[model samples]
Target: MLPPPLNHTSSILVIGAGTWGCSTALHLARRGYKNVTVLDPYGVPSPIAAGNDVNKIMEHKELRDSNPDARSIAFATCTRAALNGWKNDPVFMPFFHETGVIVSGSTPDLIRHIEKDEIDSSKGDFITLKTAQDFRNTMPPGVLTGDFPGWKGWFSKEGAGWIHAQKAMLSAHREAKRLGVKFVVDDPTGNVVGLIYQNGDVTGAKTADGTVHRADQVILAAGAGSDRLLDFKKQLRPTAWTLSHIRMTPEEAKRYRDLPVLFNIAKGFFMEPDEDNHELKICDEHPGYCNFIPDPNHPGEKRSLPFAKHQIPLEAEARARDFLRDTMPHLADRPFSFARICWDADTPDRAFLIDRHPEHPSLLIAVGGSGNGAMQMPTIGGFISDALEGKLQKELKYVVRWRPETAVDRDWHSTQNRFGGPDKVMDFQDVKENEWTRINETEKSKKSI
Candidate 1:
């Protein structure tokens, strides 16, 4: 059942100031909602949030799914809405870079699937890249110097690019603040510990310092950590992917300045280098890792928690190297300047979980990013706000509705784009000292949670 409808003057308490949380605050304020408070362990653009990165892939096109199912259609619609916001919204324009994207893979079936998708979607500008030379033709002669052996994919300038992630979050934070959203960022005050319930209804949240903040409605947008606050009964599986950055010289960065984002299913992906720092980020393709520990809230049960360690597993580094070796051999051996694991809250079906708690009516669950939170930042807040107002579009509400029954028997294998199962996802406990990359002095100074 949906929670009661909210009013303009309702006291809303939002936990977690990550991408989704800040967006929720901004959208609520835009809709004339008064008295909204956002609490987080860190300030806007929290260093630990997955979206608080140098850059992230953005989809701008209206690519329809081949299957045309309701869930896939919902995803496509939401992405189009977000792209619209990114293109026209003043707060997001400065951070968007529509440099285009190249989706390449060595698998034959995957390649054919992509080809069919382009044809069925009726995208006229999609460029087919069948050979290494073909892939390089998209960029200048000097760029993509590596031999893209056996690479088969397509390039589209119509609806793909990357965004300045951290900066975007900062901008949204500033905009939300401009609209009078209160932010509690201090350690004890922002570190929410539990929900405050009365008469079988949630009324507020209690922080680490024992500060109980009362509210007419409470929104849980904690991203990966949402499961820790309240058990979703396995509806949310906390997972993490690995990312590393290669530092390049100013001249080297200039050569690759406007290069499109490159993605290969079997290897990895990389976007344009950061203009200011000249660091090109890359990530390996594989099933994300899970860090399971005894649940503090539920002593006898285990939970997957987000680990903020700056160093990544050696295997992750090796995969990144393999991707670079195949596409950009010159930089394959170059040691990473920095590396870290980005956490995400994944649902079994990869759709978002944005509905009210069936038991606790006043508490709303607005999580399940499934690694697509960055792209949805622009319009996710509107979806969340609509849910609170009891007017969310039927398509979106239907896909994101709360359902514990589906959680009982999760089939991670059915999740799209994921390649492996439990055997592939490395457990945090199994990572040995030798398996971890050396942490530099800069990263050493930063403490892990």
Candidate 2:
């Protein structure tokens, strides 16, 4: 006599069809889960979601020289494999362009790492140059100038580059839908307004128009808006990056046409060339705009994002001009075609949280990109799926725990990209009187409640 066969028909509900949720859906389908569903206010590729960005860097390797023995480096080794998987797959490879990544002003150790990677992996090839003459002969004569006085850098031409994130995510969503994963967005049941729970267990969710959507488990990968749906407000702080694009004349674009993606470590900026090789996109990569929409019903609570009408503040605009002056002076005088904020759901250690809810084991949350989550799109899905199946590996699970500290936020934001003006940043907290203080006070109130 054998015990009753285990029931394997539990349904799963996912909120937000953004990167994490969509990726999770794909991996769940791959794992043979027949009833995985994703819910979002807007359909796949929310126009305002950070994953909808034009481009994002896919770091070929982890270059952390500060701690030589860190486990993160090994973790990156695994992630790099997943990146290569995407690059090899025909359907997905188109979105991941391995044009190359250039890191500047880095230490001697990083240069050595690049050198070693060149030899070990055929995907990465290294290039190093020194002196002004070397710059003229090897790269565009004025690309690395007096702005970066004491910086020596290297490039990995293989296995590193940028991804057309928006297209890739939409494709992944389509693939997941094709493979039996359910996606609910812009639906008549209305947008999810709350979580449904019973007997101290999270069983499902509720929609804005008072409809209930039940599931055995729920994964909330709503990006920065996670705080609005769940009580991880203290753990996940939503943030955005400052992105600028200079309208280059044809001659100017041709001059920099083949320039590789660049990282000016000391100056705190990076440049991502568009696919057409016409527009050059630059970002300070510093504490970007941490803007939010104040939740009307939940006074003092906020959702991190740009609604359709969000605008980039004036100081951030000025900072872009200053960054251009410091990095590419020729382009500094050119008119900027666009400047905007790219939101990210950040965690304390700059790591992400992907685990069961602290209070409800039946519910899971995946937020906290810390501005660098998009690149991991190819692999994060598997991790989320594994977590849901109680089979997530030990190494990453350790790093993605539910630890929250406010000091990290302060320290992370302290290194302001002043550019030139002393009062240069006009993030949400700065533009609105008492906005920053309001968040802190609100968090305190939540703790009390």
Candidate 3:
């Protein structure tokens, strides 16, 4: 049976003040949903949220799924809306840098997808660049001095670049607050421990401090930490990817500032440096990592969990160095400012999980970022709110619907469209003593959380 429809005065509690949570609150408020409360361990731009970063790639045509499904097509539509918002929305425009994007060295399948997109939707904006010089010609004269070698792919001049991620998230949080969305950021009260149930229906959430924040509806948007609170029946696996930053001088930042976002599926990708901090961020493209810890909800079962740490694996650092040496050799040997392993919940098909719980009528789940969540930020909430209102389009509803049947066992490793990284998922604790990029004294002493 369907739960009662939510009204504006209904008490709506959103857990995890991360990207999806904040976006949902903002959209809900904009839609006149009053009495909405958001709970999190921190305020806007939570340290744990994957979107909380120096910058992230803006929307681009090359990142679309090769064999598009109904869900992929729906997300593509969302990407169109997101591009419009990034270009015109006052809240997000200032942070979007439309420097265009050059995708190179991708797998054969992705290359085919690029070729197809060029023919189907380029409209003269998306075209092929077959050589390293071809890639460099797109940027100003002084940027991208690397030996492009095997780098050859497509480029699109419209609706692509990087966005100041942290600032964008903060902007959303502020707007949501201005719309009268209440936020709780204190520990115990903000730290959600579990859900409160009444007669088999979720009635509220219990925080770490023994307080139960009752609500008429509860939405779980806790990116990777969802498994710790409730069992998703092996549908969601917490996985992580590593990213590092290179500190650059003011002049260097300026020289490289106009470079289009450089991406290589097999090697890695990097974007312009932070204008103020001048920290050039680079991420190693990989299948992602898994850290198996005891599942809190299921006492005897062990599931992959995310461990918040600043140190990254030594192999990850090596990969980053290799990418830099090949692309921007000047900064290849530069010591990293720091590194982090960002975590996200992985669904088997890389599609999002956004549907009401089959058994718990009062609960809704909105997660499974699968590394594509950041680009959909501007419009993802609309889908969630529509789903909550029982008005989501039929095509998308099935894509994000709750389906435990797709759940794989603990031995499952993601092989879907992943090109780089090792075939097997690396266990967090499997790294030996010296196999970590321990940058500082604090990082060296911190073994595990």
Best model number under TM-score: 1
Q: Decide which is better by lDDT, 1 or 3.
A: 1
How well does candidate 3 match the true structure in TM-score terms? Answer: 0.92
Worst 10 residues of 3 by lDDT: 440-449
TM-scores for all candidates? 0.93, 0.78, 0.92
Look at candidate 3 and give me any clashing residue pairs: none
Best by lDDT: 1
Candidate 2 — which pairs collide?
Answer: none
Which residue pairs in candidate 1 collide?
none
Writing each residue's lDDT as its tens digit, candidate 1 over 11-93 gives 99999999999999999999998899999888777767888888999965454555577777778878888988889999888
Q: Lowest summed-lDDT stretch of 10 residues in model 1? A: 414-423
After superposition, the stretches of candidate 3 with alpha carbons farther than 4 Å from their true spots are 60-68, 106-124, 294-301, 408-411, 441-449
Quote the RMSD, in angstroms, for model 1. Answer: 2.6
* Model 2 per-residue lDDT at 98: 70
Residue-wise C-alpha lDDT for candidate 3, range 1-449, written one tens digit per residue: 56756899999999988888888898999999999999997667776789888788875443344577676676666778788878888878888998877776744665675455433443537667777677768777756667777666667777888888778778888999999999998566899988998888898998988889999989999999887888888888898889888878898888888678888776789998887678889998888888877767669877887877777898999898888876778788988876888989888878899999998888999999888887777778888898888898888888889988888453456556666777567788688868888777553333211
Worst 10 residues of 2 by lDDT: 440-449
